[model samples]
Target: MTDIPSSLEDVAEACGTRAALALLAHFEGIDLYFPHNPRPDHPILQALGPEDGPAVCHYMAGETVTIPNRSPAKRRARILALHEQGLSTAAIARKMHQTQRWVREVIRRAGEDDQGDLFG
Candidate 1:
């Protein structure tokens, strides 16, 4: 079971059929690597049933599943690791799928964490 965001699940669970249906529609054609029922042909009426249908949109989402560097600490560590591997700024940008500016910022901040103060 993938780590689905509790907020998304909670809201979908409580917001009734209209909301559930909308969420279902939003996830249309999405591929999920989780335990979900992807029976779109079952119609919206079945989604209104007393089951876990409303919450899970059959698409994987959350801090764990999609985003590799979810936290500031993890992001910094990843940046430092890739930098140590001698990857260029542009390569790191491509690997991290982040802007070159953001990658530079992470590398700078992470360097500061490790070296205390390079300028001092």
Candidate 2:
């Protein structure tokens, strides 16, 4: 099953998990062109900031990369797992590069799903 994770494993190895996840969070399902020599204002730099941007751009210089899409079920499962691990909604959102409201909604929906059919 293809997902954001599998797609980014190589990038994670090349850079780091945080940088890869940052790319996924910012540019998923988009085609990003990495210039051979990028300026400070490059989109990748903009997304990953100064700390990670240079490394990623250096690794992928002169390439047009197609960022993968996040699988919904996998994403939900990950959210649940992180929540189970005692990470707060804000932490999960930061780790997953999502909004706290979105994380809360996912948790709430998972709870509803776990309850099953009430009238059945």
Candidate 3:
């Protein structure tokens, strides 16, 4: 078996093709090529830190899949604004047309403090 190369260019060179063509095929097409070296480095991956490395999944037999982490709490707070509009749990539930349980949960979460609020 051929060893995986440490760099894209090296891989392309080993495959007897131009690096750009290899990149285009790997990036634009359905097939994915993992490095033989096992721990190849890319500029974007380097920037994200090892713990935040991108995950790869396959859907179709040869397709690539990518999933990112959920947004931080501060970003999710935008959705909480709807609860702060002084609507009753039942009314909020009706306005959002969500289940009462969901509406209550949102209100509870919105009012929670360090000690946690009782008026959820």
Candidate 4:
């Protein structure tokens, strides 16, 4: 679960994985402004609560940050898991915020034999 995107590496290193993931989940694909002096009502604070909020503030005070919405490896794993669970490509696409073609492609790619694995 600590497998955070590289963009959030500094935050994850500074604050820990839970905090970084929380930030990612809440603020992915959006530019978020973290105030130097975060008020009690700041969204970061509200989302992360007392334990992690100040840690993030201490790390990146007065910064505007955008967490990436997609982690390629994570997305692939999710797609495969959904596929294994008997979800249709269209349903998986809708659920994962991806196009059906993309879902199908991931599914197809996952089933391909890995050339490198033969040596192992």
Candidate whose lDDT is highest: 4
Q: State candidate 3's TM-score.
A: 0.27
lDDT of 1: 0.52
Off-target runs (Cα >4 Å) in candidate 1 are: 6-69, 116-120
Query: lDDT per residue, candidate 1, 18-94, as tens digits?
Result: 54344334433223233345454443324344344434434322322231222556656787799999999899877
lDDT score, residue 48, model 3? 31
TM-score to native of every candidate shown: 0.42, 0.54, 0.27, 0.56
Question: Which should have the higher lDDT, number 1 or number 3?
Answer: 1
Q: Write the per-residue lDDT of candidate 2 for residues 67-97, one digit (tens) a residue.
A: 8767767877888999999999999887775
* Sort order, lDDT high to low: 4, 2, 1, 3
Clashes of each: 0, 0, 1, 0
lDDT of each prediction vs. the true structure?
0.52, 0.82, 0.40, 0.83
TM-score of 1: 0.42
lDDT of 3 by residue, 1-120 (tens): 132233334333443333324333334312344322224375223433343223221111233323121233532353366656666667655544345686676557666653555697
- Alpha-carbon runs more than 4 Å astray in model 2: 1-4, 72-120
Regions of candidate 4 where Cα sits further than 4 Å from its true position: 71-120
Worst 10 residues of 2 by lDDT: 1-10
Misplaced by over 4 Å in model 3 are 1-79, 113-120
Ranking by TM-score: 4, 2, 1, 3
